[model samples]
Target: MAELQGFVFPRTATGRSSILPAPPWHYSGDLLTIEYRTDPERVIELLPDPIEPADDPGAVALVWADWQSCSDTFDELLDPVRAQYKEVFFVVRGRYQGEHVSRCVYIWVDKDYALVRGHYQGYPKKLGSIHLTRPVAYGKAGPRLEPGGRFGATLAAYDRRLAEARFTITGTADQGGFVNSHAMLHTRFLPAIEGAQAPPSLHELVTMKTVDVDAGPVYVGDADLTLFDVPGEEFGRLAPREMIGAYYRQVGATFVGGTTVHSYDD
Candidate 1:
């Protein structure tokens, strides 16, 4: 598998802010038991049908994407991709109010999906024979993952800075600050894969429908992704709307991102 790549936001005055928070999949009991690839086709299918602008000038645009975590299956998915591709990249971004920010996560891997199961499971799988489950939304700390070496180190640095900012006297210390960053990451990956195919027209994609799939809560474990680091391979790219359209087909999703062609209507 590729090395885990992410951003490390500067610490806020309070000491509680991180660009990479505990993703929803960590505590949601989401089984990291699915496989994915940079399939432009599948990304299109996941998007919602574009809606006509409401007469009211305040209607927000809608979009959809999937999320998973580091599980046994994730290792399965990475085994093959690790051998096939020299590097695996995860892209993310978000829009809030009137501004947008994005980032890229790049890793080194030769093959793709040699160890993963089929399809990306965005939600928690229902267990017919399971006993109890924990649905703990992160508290002030945000979220936690079983940290490894390299990837874990990066996350730790980010988490420490975030914590410092959160506790700063002048800062709000609320998880709100990181919200936009995380949202940007989630949204950023969408375009990464979305543009991989035909590359959506500038205006076509930034303004489509989004559906939030019902993902039941899940619990996740930690895996060591530091051993697979490739210096030049770990990176990120942020683009403007105009430039964004240009990259649609240039870079697709990572082998773990997802597969399956989709359209706004699908």
Candidate 2:
């Protein structure tokens, strides 16, 4: 029998995937997190049907991270370049079924694998340049996790700066200060290739599932953000109206996959 097999794309006879490895992908990273209040109407526009704005309708968070990731084999750890990537995302609060959930509106990642992996989990992921200040124990100019620490992060695509953030740490914070204290909502959409005028072949509301999740200590701070009015991007619509909170934290988690909550096809 002749066959080709793999969990991801470009399958081989030996069952080796060309782009991504097997499941249970793990990640550890340092993040610069910022929370703010955007326009309520803007939030309404981004959230899909049946998911209305939460009590704090205009509330949102943007996070920039420098990450190190690996699959089951964890071989990428040894080849650090393969494992290192940076990403930034914007998440808004929505109420679904009387329950609060987080919805990621826009996200940018540095690596192709990270983009593809994020797409699988229903994130609206795009490729971009993401940078953040990495904290060090001996850093004197700022970029430390302790009090008075200052960090900066930036996101850019197509040679244009889209957004940036700066956080100045005041003290330590608990999980409650974290923006995503609840589950996140997403939409997995695969457009139809069979027909030029056909609708998306796969479209569904979904929620991600993570295993061995660790919520690391958070550094609370005053945050400042700027969203550039890019010619082609609509993310600027969610421009900050009021700064809410900021954080610097370390996180570790595994991407186990997700479950569909609703199918538009039905």
Candidate 2 per-residue lDDT over residues 1-266, each given as its tens digit:
76878777888887766678878899998877788888899988888898987887888888898999998999999988889999999888888899999888999999998998888888899999988988888747546678887788889999999998777889987653435677989999888998758989899999888889786787888888999998879988898888888888889999887888889988
Error of 2 at 104 (Å): 0.5
Q: RMSD in angstroms, candidate 1? A: 19.1
Off by over 4 Å in 1: 1-208, 220-227, 236-266
* Candidate 1 lDDT, 1-266, residue by residue in tens: 44343322434554334233222222111212101122233233333333211122121111111123232234423643222212122333333333443222222122223111111122111111111111224753332322211111121121121100001111111221121123222211123445657553322222211223333322222222221222322211111111111000011122223222224433
Listed in order, each prediction's TM-score against the native is 0.21, 0.94
Clashing pairs in model 2, backbone N/Cα/C closer than 3 A: none
> Candidate 2 — which residues are off by over 4 angstroms?
139-142, 176-178
